[model samples]
Target: MIKQGLLVRAAVPACVLTGGAVAGGVSPIAWATGLVFGLALVLLTGWGLQRTGRGEFGPADWITFARATLVGCAAELIADGGHPHAWLVGLIAVALLLDGVDGQVARRTGTSSEFGARFDMEVDAFLILLMCVQVAETAGLWVLAIGLMRYAFVAASWAMPWLTAPLYPSMARKTVAAVQGVVLVVAVAGILPVLWTVAAVVLALASLVWSFGRDVVWLARTRVPAARPSAIVAITRRRAAPHHGPTWPAHNQAA
Candidate 1:
């Protein structure tokens, strides 16, 4: 089952690369990069499935895999440096549109799992990062922050373990994240005036900052310190103690 699932997943990248070659005359560099990205994505995903003890890809995972393929194509386009704006924008737009679909499918199908959720999130993050790269060419390098913030927060968690706590779901956070992709895609499409594109990206970044800050503060407030070894031992001992209280009431005893 796993083998078949992986083969199916592998085909996505193959099709994407072939389509790019025929449609736009993919440069050697772009073709090579796309192949590497596709191979790495397949290998890593296979490793993850093995590590997680999953036998086959779930329905939602397939959706996320498709989205990831689109990102890979976008990366190839970025590498080629002569991609049509319409093609790039179309790929990203479809990917973004399918973003919410995977979650809904997972929920309805009862296949939701940590791996699936993480896979979905990683795809979203990478897409945003790629879009940021595209937008930065015109919007200024400050645009990269919108993509790098999540990774920065993740790195901070290694030093401050409290930041690793699971965050409560907030619609505001989801909204902020969704906005980043939409805004970046718009900026990439170059439909808006330069000033307006800059303004929209600025607003997106601001919202992202606010969302991350709010979560960090909440984490700090609710942070619980890890128990010391001695304290843990004491707790174990107390719980291990046997009850020795009398079973009879005082009146019955007197009688």
Candidate 2:
């Protein structure tokens, strides 16, 4: 949760700095001035925000928050717009280092929450999109498609309600998603050109496809049958449980 707050706050300033640097034409003097200012803001504000409040704040929260702020800055730096190459790469590496640590902080501190999970997830997503946009400028428009792949699945959930059902998380999948950003970042940094970038994009897309396919199959098989429960299971029931929850449950039951 602290990490999420850190990223959400950092994103705004990162975007602003990126724009300012680009608009100001990437002068060495301007870059140095902006770099110092950005670093100061990220450290002071991010650290302060993470350490705020008497009850919610803790060492772990501060640590994770610190990690996220550093990484988020790196992500913004590498994300096109004439950000310095060494600083951009350095920040990204720092972000990845903190990524592993933040969750440990949350777990050790016992401060993990849905808020934190969602916050981290969105931060990661936005970072991917940012990297995709920067990479696409060089790789090809098809590379941009990778950025929207997650959104495509998210939107499809509206049409196929069952698609929204959660599946048990896997570390392998998480690893794939995490590395996807790194691949694109490196690809755009010209460590690898269009050829390698395309391959990375393809593999990333395939990973998402596999994940969705498994979940869809699970939903199809495990979804409750559209009938009353067996007589034995129904013996102690007050009423049949709704097939869905809230919005879907109310509507499906009414229908």
Candidate 3:
């Protein structure tokens, strides 16, 4: 059980600073600024609301939250027109690397909870969105499909309630999620030309579309009128059990 107070308290200051970071800018890149600050605020507030009760916040959450902060910073840098540097790449690479650490910390230390699971997933989704903004700078908006896929799925769920159903564990889904960050990071770091970056993002988007599509079709076929979430669901507030899988945030179980 997660107590609501902890996250809200800890996140308020960082969020305020992040807001000022957005407002103080002379001319922040529109897409970049909105993507970074918007996602950061959503993550902080959404996850804060999900956390409740009297559970220990745990080491894993701290690590994951730190990574999320770094992602917000990366987005801010892009908004300010700071070209990508080895240091920025390194920072994001660290965030990606630390993704695995949170899950492990939760499982081994027996600190896993629904809140932790959602926290991890939100961080992953937001970070992907931020990186997508950078990749789009060179690879075109087509590349954004990869980062936006998760959010798009969530939005569709609002209209199609069956899409909110918990999905079965799939290694393919986890692999696809992890690969998106690496490919986009590579593209953003200027490791690939625009052609390769767009091509790679397209492939990744296709895989994501396929994975989510399959899940949707399955949900449609097996829709249980009773078990369905509200039509207007809290997309990030999934009550999933924690899983120690290759995916940074894996598992599907109601709180």
Candidate 4:
């Protein structure tokens, strides 16, 4: 399964390089860079996935990474002017859909790991960042919200380190992240409005807020109860007798 996955990743760069070479117009630099980038991506992911599998490979991680890379590579091509020549929209859309699946796979397959989680997250973040950069070139700087949202969250973590914990996946948050890609792809493809760009930014921010809140709540509630207080401590806090008579009366000798 891992080998097959690596093969799939390699195909993208191979195709890009072969096509770029044949075109003979775009800089060989771009094609070479794409190849190197793709190679590095595959190597890094391949190693991570392998180590992850040492614990166990979840079907969801495989599917999620596959879908992410497929959509990601397609998005890159479309954003770079390989548009109209391929089903870039559908490609990107599929990637967005898969965003929700890998975690499911990981959970179901019992293959979830910290390494896998971070690995998958970084890939997703980079792909969105790539899309945002491409869109911003023409859509203006605001379009950058799509990509910068992750970085902004990372920045927030520096201030409040608590932001990093229990970053569990949420459907609403996933939807918001996916929208950033869809809006950028469609907008760049000339199908969406410039004003809609603002909506993307809004959703991205909202997701960050929701994620932070959810984490805080989860952390607050998930604490393991400490062992029942020692019997001695419990007894010390208890009164020896009910207050049938007022102790203050004795001190004052009023009665």
lDDT of each: 0.81, 0.58, 0.67, 0.58
Superposition TM-score, candidate 1 onto the true structure: 0.84
Best candidate according to lDDT: 1
Ranking, TM-score, top scorer first? 1, 3, 2, 4
The TM-score of candidate 3 is 0.73
Badly placed stretches (over 4 Å) of model 1 are 21-24, 224-255
The C-alpha TM-scores of every prediction are: 0.84, 0.60, 0.73, 0.60
Residues forming the 10-long window of minimal summed lDDT in candidate 1: 246-255
Error of 2 at 118 (Å): 1.1
Off by over 4 Å in 2: 1-80, 224-255
Candidate 2, residue 186: Cα displacement in angstroms equals 2.1
Instruction: Give one digit per residue, the lDDT tens place, for model 3 in 1-255.
Output: 344645553565367436535543635463456455655555564556445553445777777667766666676666666543675587689889898899999899998877778878988897888788877877778777778888998899899886766665568779888778778788778888777777888887888888877777656754634364452143223324354643222222221
RMSD of each: 11.0, 9.7, 9.0, 11.6
Q: Please list the residue runs of candidate 3 whose C-alpha ends up more than 4 Å from where it truly belongs after superposition.
A: 1-56, 224-255
**Clashing pairs in model 1?**
none
True-vs-predicted CA distance for residue 178, candidate 2, Å? 3.2
| lDDT at 159, model 3 | 91
Where is model 4 more than 4 Å wrong at Cα? Answer: 1-30, 46-57, 75-79, 155-160, 167-175, 178-182, 196-255
